[model samples]
Target: MKIENIRPGDIEAESFRIIGELLGDRKLDPRYEHIIKRCIHTSADFDYADSLYFSEGAEERIARGIREGAVIVTDTKMAQAGINKTRIGKYGGQVLCYIGDSDVAEEAKSRGLTRSYVSMEKASRLGRPVIFAIGNAPTALMAICDLAEAGQLDPVAVIGVPVGFVNVEASKERLIRSGIPCIVARGRKGGSNIAACIVNAIQYSL
Candidate 1:
């Protein structure tokens, strides 16, 4: 992918294509295809409108899951904070949270909130594939895939929604490494907004 030409919206399209390819041989219900199409169109709709090119409140939704003890993993403080706020706003308390930071992990543990540091190794051991956002944490994402390959983490799915232009391929690489079929945004166009949209689609699909 051309880093210079990459945009967040482009990644959203790529993710849809990848998911379609992954489901090629599966007994995918029409509903599943509808969900993907709706999501893709929704994203494109926003992009075409020239207003609100990203999904709002994604961090909050992720945080809600984390608060519910969903073994979440993310690579950005903004995402982490957004997730936390979502949990707090919806659940009115701290969620069983873990973060990529050592200090945050320790803090969560100190509070006895079922906290642990997020690492690929740890995420893999959690017995579930996690939705990974694109960020600067390629190493961590790769580690998560390694663990999945080693059977440490049996992730249900993977996603490549890298925000901004840096390392868009990292999320895709993680999805490939995890070997858990997933939906991802393509190229350097992915960002936090696109990643969150994909997650929303997954949640709605389920």
Candidate 2:
């Protein structure tokens, strides 16, 4: 038998070095490289380096909004829990998830919509700038996009990364075609944790 020990910081530092090596000569857009890097770090998937897409100036706008007290509205509680709340709070912003709220549930039932869709509808009412982070439920992404297109809601930015076989790719494709500011993961390979990582990456940078 053999035993070895290393400092946690040292381990993480080495891990990042390995991640960089795994990346090789691959190049990201540079503007949103840090955000993608954090996603890859969280998932240990180098493919994210290319899969993640950012609308022009999306990172800068979202970062500035966060600094200026913009609110974060996530589709699921998992995403709310995963984000860096303390950092956002420093700028008087908070993370919200209405999935478990009674009103949201009731509204979803009454409207024949998913809870995530109703959550976005509720979030659209917030007078403050809202950054919708949807890492689950393609219906939610569709709802937000509909609102934005109708000029019913004006979100500061959208982070769309819903994961599933159904409607996931379609919802993301809709966002890409949209003129709104967004950070998205193309295809059907994203989740709440990935959404949180993108938000935290921006928050930590600031």
Candidate 3:
């Protein structure tokens, strides 16, 4: 086995120093900066800092939900797997994915709805405060917003960052106006990894 004397903690510390240097005179509210840095770090894309949209106090709301043991639901299995589940577990959060599940498939087929919408419907029924970490399927993001507005699903926070030209921009825009605490990536640049990165940043902070 290859064993190193240095602990894993050193890497993040060093990376932070480098990131800080590269960031230069540009500044964000310190409280929200780490989330941007983490996203960029995860994808090596500097555009995330400008792309991320946050509601007032969204970070605090999300952290509180995490500490309160919110059920974290993802629209895709890739997103579910990409989250730092170990870190989420530290705060009593559990990740959930209903996509590709037999029940979800059956319901989607029955209703002629996308599995993403079915997953959001299921998330609503968890009865616990939900932190939706969606990275694919703009349909899920749009559905969650509609459900929230219609007095159906009441998610504590939504991380909506699906990538593509189709409905990607529109869904995120809807989340901004959905009246829920949201951290969204606007425009056509997002994916499962970026979505998971945002979740991990909040978990790491608290």
Among the numbered candidates, top TM-score falls to 2
Report lDDT (Cα) of residue 78, candidate 1. Answer: 47
Tell me the tens digit of each residue's lDDT in model 1 across 141-179.
Answer: 555566666657664444445544444465555565444
> Per-residue CA lDDT of candidate 2, range 1-206, in tens?
67548787797667667777888897777677778888988899877887888888888889999999999999998999999889799899999988999999998899899988888888888888999888998998999989988898888899999999999999999988988899999999999999999999999889
Pairs of residues at least 3 apart in sequence or in different chains that clash in candidate 3? none
- The TM-score between candidate 2 and the true structure equals 0.95
Off by over 4 Å in 2: 1-4
| Each model's lDDT | 0.46, 0.89, 0.87
Ten contiguous residues minimizing lDDT sum, candidate 3 = 3-12
In model 2, what are the clashing residue pairs, if there are any? none
RMSD of each: 11.8, 1.6, 3.2
Each model's total of backbone clashes: 15, 0, 0
